[model samples]
Target chain A: MPLRTLLQADDVRRAITRMAHELVEHDPDADRLLLLGIPTRGAVLARRLAAEVARIAGREVPVGVLDVTLYRDDLGTQPTRATGRTDVPADVDGATVVLVDDVLFSGRTVRAALDAVTALGRPAVVRLAVLVDRGHRELPIRPDSVGRNLPSAKSERVRVLLTETDGRDEVTIE
Target chain B: MSDHLLSTRDLSRDAAVALLDVAEDMADTQRRTVKKLPTLRGTTVVNLFFEDSTRTRISFEAAAKRLSADVITFSAKGSSVSKGESLQDTAQTLQAMGADGIVIRHQASGAAAVLATSGWTRAAVVNAGDGTHEHPTQALLDAFTIRKRRFGAGSRGRDLAGLDVVIVGDVLHSRVARSNVWLLTTLGATVRLVAPPTLLPTHIESWPVEAGTDLDAAIADGPDVVMMLRVQRERMTEAFFPSAREYAALYGLSAARADRLRADALVMHPGPMNRGLEIAGSVADSPRSTVLEQVENGIAVRMAVLYDVLAGERTA
Candidate 1:
C-alpha cells in the first residue's frame, strides 16, 4: 500500500517556477523586487520562489520572512495557528514587495501580512502570491498570482508539509 | 517545563538572568542603523489582546518587529470573540492556522496560565498582561531599570544578587508586585513587603520575604531600594487607606521622607504615577529615581522576554 500525496514535491516546484517567471515578466525591473515568506511553510515556499526567480531572472533577489502571529485575533479568544514575527530586510523602501505564503484561506493571513508589510516601510507596490488558493473568502482578498486553486470545506484542515521541515514535500487534507 | 513563558515563577534564577542578558543584546537593536533582525526569521507571533492597552500592545509590536517575527495583532473589539466563542475554540483555530507563538492579554488573571496548560495551540505562549495576576515582563523590566540606573548598561550579564529591596503600597492587587517578588527573590535579592494591613495578601507570609505595614520605618530602615506601588482606585471603592492625601503624607515617598534613605539608594514605582499618592512627582523624577528607567528598560525587558520564550534555545 502506497501513501497519499495531495500535491507532490515536483508539482510544487513546477508551479512555483511558472509563477516566478510570471512575477518577473509582470514586474520587469527585478531590482526593486523582494520576496517575503510568511512563517512555517510559507517561508519555505518563498525561499523556493526566490531560488526559482534567481535561475530565471539571472539575479538573487533579497528575501525576507514575515511572522504575523501576533496580529491574529483568534488566539486564546478562539482557535489560532502558530505565529512568529515579521522580518523585512533593510532595503524595502521604494521596492515592489511580493508577499509569499503556502495557503490562502479566509484571507486572514494575507490581511495580517498586509498589516505587517505596511509596518516595515512604504513598498512602491505590494503583491500577494500563494501556493494554493483554497477558496473560502471571508475577507475581500485576492492573490495576484496563485499556484493551485483547491477547494476545501470550512471544517477540513489543509496542511502544507515540506521536506526541509516536515520530512516530506506534500500538501495534505487531514 | 514546556516552552511557554506564562509567568516569572516558572523560570529559574539562571534562566531569568539569561533572559535579561538576551534582552541586553536586543536593546542594542535601538543603536543599530537598521533596527531589525532575522533571528526569529520564519516564526509567527500572534498578539491576542482581549483588553485594551496602548503602550504594552505597541511595545510588544515594536519588539516583535525588531526581532523580525511575523506579528498578527488581534483585538476582539467587534470580532468573533464578542460572539461568545469559547477560549478553546479560539486557541484551536490559531493551532489549525499554524501560530508559532501567542502573546495574549486577557481580563482574567490566570487566563494565560490556563492557555499555556491547555493543549490548544502548539505555539509558545507569552503573557503580555493578565487580570491583576502577573505581568512578568513588567517586573523584569523594572529589575533591568534598577540594575541599569544603579550599575549602568555595561553591567549586562549580571544578576540581582544581594540587593535589599522593599515594595510598599498596594500589593494585594498588583500583578507587577507579584512578579517582582517571585523573580527578585529567585535572583537572591532580599525582598521585604510593606503595605497597609488590608492591602497585603494573607498568604503572603508563605513566601520567603519580610512583611509589615510600617511605611516610614521601611524607608527609615535605609534599605537599598524602595518601591512604592500605585493605589488602584478603581479596584478599591471603600478606603484601603484613610485618604489619598493621608496615604501620601504617611506612606508616600515625599521629599523629606526620600531624604531619610541612603544617599545612594534607589526609588521606584511602576507608573502611570499618581503625583501625590504612592510617589511624588519630584521623587519619581529625582536623581535616585528609576521610574523613567523602568519605562525605557521595559522595551528591552519585553524584548528579552519574547526572545527567551521564542528563541528555541534551551538547556537542562
Candidate 2:
C-alpha cells in the first residue's frame, strides 16, 4: 500500500490516554516523574501526555522539550541539522525522567537524547516512551512504553502526524 | 551557509537569520549547568591571530572548547610570524598538522579573503577581524543582541526590520561598524552613522546609510538603538580630530545626549570603551546598555559560526 492509516485520530487519542494511565500507575506518587518530548511532533505529544497524567494522578508532572540534534553521532558524516529548543523545566537530579517521542526507528535519536539528558543533569532513572515503534534496530535500544508496535521493512516510511503541528493526529505507513 | 565566514555581505537575509537562530540555540545551551556539546568532537580549530586581541581570541577559543573542538591559538607576536614567516608557510604547517578550521585576525585588509580563496590549506576559514575590513562574528553577535533585546523570547526567525539604529564615533577605522552596516541593512534595519567629518570615510555617500557629523541630530531623531563605536586612539597617527575634549563634546554619548534618546532605546558599544571620550562612564554602565550582553553573546555567535563552517564535511 502506498498510503495506509495505521492509527486513526481516535486510536491515537486512546493510545495517549492509555499511556498516561500506565505512567500514573507506574508512578502513583507522581513527585519526580518528568516527561521530556523530542522536538517537532514529539513535543506536542508530550504536552498532551502531561495533561492526561495530571488529570489521572491529580498532580502536574513537569514537561520539557529535548532536542537531540547537537548530540547526534552523524553530524560530522551527514548534513548539519537545525537544533531545537532543549528546555528542561526543573532540575533532573534524582528524578525519574521519561523521554517521549513520536516514532522510534534507528534508535539513534534516542541515543542522542540520552547523551543530552546526561549532560543536563544526573537523573535517578531514565525511560523511553514512543507513539510508534517500527522494527529497525540499529542500536541496542528498546522503549519502556510503546503505543503501537508495527512490524515493517526497512524500506518503508512511517510518519506520525499531530494536530498541534501537522493539523491532524494519526499514524501512517507508506 | 558557506564553508568560510569572510564577510556578512556574503550572507543573504535568510542565511544571516539562520545563523542568528542557531546562535540562539547555542545561547540556550550556554545557560545550562553543563555548557559543553560534542558537536565538533575530534575536530581541531586553530585560532590564527596575527594581531594582539586577547578578548576576541579568548571568545573564539571558548566557543571552540564549548563545542568540544581542540583549539590551538597561534599569536603572531612571539610565533614564527615574528621571524618573518609568511602566511603561506604558516598555513602549510597548520595543514600538515591536520587543522580542520582556521580563525584568522590579520592587520592587512583582504587578508582573510585571500586566505579563504587561496589554496594554502583545505581547512575552513573564519575571519575574526581584518584591517578595517569586517568582523563578521562581531556583527553577528551585535545583531543577535539587538534581536534579543527587541523581540525578547520571540527572537528566533525574526529580523530587525523597521528599527532605527544610530552608530556614532570613528567610522573610518571600525571593522565592527563596517560589518554592522552591511549586515543590519541587509536585515532591514535603518542605520545612521554620526562621527567627525575627518573620521567619517570619504565614500560614506555610496554606503546605504545616512552619514552625518551631528551626533545631537541623530540622538534627537529618537532612534530605537544608539551604538557608540570606540574611538581608535592608537590608529590616530595624524590629526583625525582637533582634540579629545572637542570630539567628546561633538560626538560622545554624554549625559545630555543620552537624556535626549527614547527611554527604551538601547545603548550599545562594541567596547574597550574610552569611557569619557566616546561614551560617558555612567552611560556605558546604564541599565539600557548592552555592552556586557554583547560580549556574552559573542561566544554564542562564534559557536554558531564555527559549527556552521566545521560541522559538515567540506563540499567543494
Considering every candidate listed, which one attains the maximal lDDT?
Answer: 2
For model 1, how does the per-residue alpha-carbon lDDT over A19-61 read when each residue is reduced to its tens digit? Answer: 8988998898757898999888888888889899899989888
lDDT of 1 by residue, B1-316 (tens): 2367778888788777666666665565455445665546677888988888777887888888777789898887887899998788888988887788899988889999788878787778888778888888888887777677667756566778889899988898888899999988888899999888988898986888999988877877778889988888877867787788878876788988898889999998887789888888888888998877777777777766666566643221
State the C-alpha lDDT per candidate: 0.79, 0.91
List candidate 2 segments past 4 Å from native. Answer: none
Q: Write the per-residue lDDT of candidate 2 for residues B191-248, one digit (tens) a residue.
A: 9999888988988888999999888888888999999999987777899988899999
Worst 10 residues of 2 chain B by lDDT: B307-316
- With a 3 Å backbone cut-off (N, CA, C), the pairs that clash in candidate 2 are none
Q: RMSD in angstroms, all models?
A: 12.1, 1.5
Query: Over 4 Å off in model 1, which ranges?
Result: A1-174, B313-316
Point to the candidate with the largest DockQ.
2
